[model samples]
Target: MKIVATPIQGVYLVETTPFQDERGSFYRAFCDRELDSLLQGETICQVNVSRTEAVGAIRGLHFQYPPHAEMKLIRCLKGRVWDVAVDLRQDSSTFLKCYQAELSADNAYMMVIPQGCAHGFQVLEAGSELLYLHTAYYEPKSEGGIRYSDPKLNISWPLKVTDVSTRDSSHPLLSEDFRGVVL
Candidate 1:
């Protein structure tokens, strides 16, 4: 696996090297030796998967607060998506900055989102699946989000959003007092 850095601190774009043969292809999706420098001492403790059924569906602009902050390594499993990450590290130079990458099964790419960032995705096909490796487990009390359409972030989604969950749509727009998370 080859790791590439993004404009935002601690975010990475990873390309997993795959070997193809007459039958199929084989690749190591994750390797501790190759990624240990980026991972620091964090270990994967949980894995999650999501399947979206509608093209243009939006999933989140979500993250957790400190005590429960998580580092996420996410990849597309079945289809394509416009995956996004927004940096919210309070003391960082790129606070509130957004970064995007196209992830699909064919691409074999993963996005590594650090603890103080919000993550979301827009489905580009009728059926899309994603796999997530998380450094921290879910904690409901630490859950937080910003509206996907928040004017402050102004995310230019690749497609016209066709569906969104009530919970996601209801996330408040970033307020003036918003100071970002301290990881």
Candidate 2:
């Protein structure tokens, strides 16, 4: 796997080298040694999967607060999606900056989002499945998110959002009163 740093610190776009043959193809999606080198000593503690059924479906802009913050290695397992990460680390050079990439089974690529970033995705095709290896387990009380269409962030989603969870729709916009810092 080759890791390329994004505009945001600690976030990366990882491209995997796939070996293909007439039978099919295979690639190493994750390796302890490789990730260890990239993350120093950070340990991945949980793995999660999300499956979306329709195009234009959106989820997240989500993150966990300090003490429960998670670093995520995210990839699309089936179909496609426009994956995005927003820097929320206060004092970071790229605070509030966003990075986006097309992730699909065909590309065999993954994105690494550090603890101080919020992550989200828009389904580019029906039946999209996403897999995430996280450095921390879910902590409901620590959960927080910004609205997908927050004017301050001005995320330019590729598609018109057709569906979103009520929770996501009800998320507060990023503002001075918000406790979480936008990295």
Candidate 3:
């Protein structure tokens, strides 16, 4: 696997080396040794999957606060999506900066979003499935999100948004008073 760093300090785009044969293809999705060395001991404790049934579905801009902050390894399992990560670490040099990548089953690429970043994705194809390996489980009390269409972020979404959860739609915009605290 190859890990490509993003503009944000701890974020990366991981590409797997696939071994193709007559039967099918094989690839190592994750290796504890390799990841432990790279991340210096970040431990993944949970795995989650999200299956979106419609094109243009938007599902985040989400992150958890201190004590429940999560580092995520994400990939598209069945279809395609425009995945995004926004730096929200207040003390980091790249705070507020954003990175985007196209994730599809065909490319077999995954994105690593560090604890201080907010992650989101827009489905580019119907029936897209996203798989995530996280360092922490969900904590509703510590969960927070910014609006997907926040003007300050100006995310260039690839498709016209067709659906969003009511809770996601009601997420507050990030404002000066709401600066995130770095962990």
The model with the greatest TM-score is: 1
Score each candidate by Cα lDDT.
0.93, 0.89, 0.89
User: 1-183, model 2: which lDDT tens digit per residue?
Assistant: 898888888889999978999999999989979877667788889998999998999999899987888889999999999999988887787888899999999999999999889999999999999999998889999897988888878888999999999999999888776544543
User: Quick one: ranking by lDDT, best first?
Assistant: 1, 3, 2
Clashing residue pairs for model 1: none
Better of 1 and 2 by lDDT: 1
Encode model 1's per-residue lDDT on 119-180: one tens digit a residue: 99999987899999999999999999989999988888999999999999999999999998
Total backbone collisions for each predicted model: 0, 6, 0
Error of 3 at 158 (Å): 0.8
Residue 86 in model 1: lDDT: 97
Error of 1 at 2 (Å): 1.1
lDDT of 2 at 183: 30
Stretches of candidate 1 above 4 Å error?
Answer: none
Of 1 and 3, the candidate ranking higher by TM-score = 1
- The TM-score obtained by model 3 is 0.96
- List runs of model 2 lying over 4 Å from the truth: 177-183
